[model samples]
Target: MTKVLPSLLASDFTRLGHDIEKMEAAGADIFHLDIMDGQFVPNISYGMPVVEAISRTASIPLDVHLMTLDPEQFIDALAALGIDMVSFHIEATNHPHRLMQRIQQSGMKAGIALNPHTPVAHIQHLLAEIDFILIMTVNPGFGGQKFIDTCVDKVRTLDALRAEKGYGYEIEVDGGINQETAEICREAGADLFVSGSHLFKSEDWQEAVREMKQ
Candidate 1:
């Protein structure tokens, strides 16, 4: 079965504690945090303080997505927190292999995220160097965007690469993932999913997550 990782970017920040509590009760496996800086992406979002705030209330593991330039400069700060996983964009880093090693050394799961236009082949050399792969189905920066149909092929390609090389990296898809697209991604070999607006904006967050896993 695919794992459901609720994107905290979609959670109600005004009542974040309660919003997270509700999601935990609804069987969310992980909390996906999108930390964006204006330089790497078009938007600027929460930093460590916000993640630290949610960290205090979250019951499940936190998968922190760092969409920023010079991610190496911030790994130490993020590692100080107790998040389970930290993923940085491959395009944002100067040395992705070294970054992955540093993340592992810091005792957090290491992950690499790919943009919609970036092919899965970009990480082929580093496949054995990371813990997970985050495939963005929509452009980064903002939420509420439509799913990119091309991502299904990307996920399949990544899956085929992993199978061919026998890597244990978890394939994660973020952005524009809803009930319908979730199944397509899963069939393409996505093991973990990140859903934001689709969960919190929907009438039923629990049902949204449950249906996405199907």
Candidate 2:
């Protein structure tokens, strides 16, 4: 089954621990933490303290998407918190290969995130070295943006490339992923679906999660 990795950035922080517990029970495969810096993106999300708190409570794996410049600085800190996976935007780094090696050296699976305009061919050479690929269906920064349908074909191309090269990197689709959009990406061979607003902002989170996972 296609996995659902819910973005906790949209969750009610006042009761985030409770929400995480609920989602884990609802069959969420992983927790996606969008680590944003005001420089890399327009927004600045919580820092290590908040992440540390979440790590203390979340039973499942934590996949941190670095939306910050110089993401290399956080590898050791994130590794210290036992982050399971870390993805840095290709646009943010000058040396993704080194970053990938460092992330893996720190004991976290390394991934690369591509913005909507970035082509699948951009990361062609790095595919074999990555553990996963995060294709941003919306511009990376804040949550609740509209999904860019154009990115679906990029997912398809990446899927085809993976098959042709026999690569094992999982394809992760983030931004505006709900049941319908998730299904669209899933059809294109996306492995991990990261849903935020559509899941956390739902009136019925269980039903929403069930919808995305299905």
Candidate 3:
């Protein structure tokens, strides 16, 4: 089954706790947090205070995606927030392996993310060292972007590589995921789906999540 991850990026901030509660009731497998810095990404999102608030509200795992240039600077802080997993963009840092080691040393599962333009082969050698991977189906930083249809192939290739190498990393897809795209990625071997604008903007949050899980 494809695990549904509701992105807090698209949540109703005024009622974020309520939204988190609703998602929990809707069977969300994990909570996806998009931590964007103005440098790496075009936009800036909420920081530690907000993440801490979210951490206190949701009982499920919080998966934080660091779309920042200095992702290593945040590892300890986010780990302190009790995030279950932390995925830094592969293009953001000079030493991903060292950073992954630091993240694990801080007690959070380490993951690496590839932008839409990056190929799975870019991180092929390090696949066995990390806990998971986040494949950007659309450009990072913003929500509501159209799903990059070509990025689905990255998921497929990563899946095949994982099988052939017997790697134990989870494949998580972010951006433009809805019920339809969820099915598409699942068929391509995605283990987790991150939903933001589409899921949050729905009239029925629970129903939207339920349909995505299906």
Candidate 4:
């Protein structure tokens, strides 16, 4: 089954608690958090405080996507806060192998994210060291961006890598993932789907998840 993770990047932060509650009731498997620092990405998003709030209210695991430079600086802090997964951009750090080790040592699921321009070979050496790989289908700054069609090809390439290595890593596709794109990713071997705008705009959020599950 494909897992549905609702991104909080597009949620109304003023009423974020309520938004998270609604998503939980709607059967979201994980709460996807997009953390950005203006330098790495184009925009600055919530920091540890906001993530703490989500961690408190979220019944499901927090799938934190760190789109900042020096993700290693904050890994310990986030891990101490008890998030389930912490994903960092492969290009953001100098030592991804050591960083993955630290994350695992801290008892959190370690993940690596790939940008639109990054290739699957960048993570080939560390494939077995990760729990999952997040493929960005859109540019990483904000929400509601158009899906980059070429991402489907990237997803398939990563899927092939995982299969060849017999690694346990899951392929998670973020950005512009709606019902139609979800099918595309799944067919390309994606196991997790991250949706923000489509989820919030849905009339019946839980039913929306059910449809994605199909």
Put the candidates in lDDT order, highest first: 2, 4, 3, 1
Alpha-carbon deviation at 147 in model 1, angstroms: 0.6
Displacement of the residue 130 alpha carbon in candidate 1, Å: 1.4
Which candidate should be chosen as best, given lDDT against the real structure? Answer: 2
Clash count for candidate 4 is 0
Query: What C-alpha lDDT values do all the predictions have?
Result: 0.89, 0.93, 0.91, 0.92
lDDT string for model 1 (162-205, tens) is: 89988889999998888888888988999998998888887877
Clashes of each: 0, 0, 0, 0
**How far off is residue 96 in model 4, in Å?**
0.6
Model 1 clash pairs are none
Candidates 2 and 3: which is better by lDDT? Answer: 2
Q: Model 3 compared with the native: what TM-score? A: 0.97
Candidate 2 lDDT over residue span 1-214, tens digit each: 6888999999899999999998898788999999999999999989999999999999999999999999999999999999999999887889989999999998999999999988877788899989999999999999999999999999999899889989999999999999899999999999899999898878887788788877
Per-residue accuracy of model 4 over 74-120 as CA lDDT, tens digit each: 98889888998989999899999999999989999999999999988
CA-only RMSD, every prediction: 1.0, 0.9, 0.9, 0.9
Error of 2 at 166 (Å): 0.2
Off by over 4 Å in 2: none
lDDT per residue, candidate 3, 4-66, as tens digits? 999999988999999999889888889999998899999999999999999998999999999
Task: Give the TM-score comparing model 1 with the true structure, all chains together.
Answer: 0.97
Q: How many pairs of residues in model 3 come into backbone collision?
A: 0
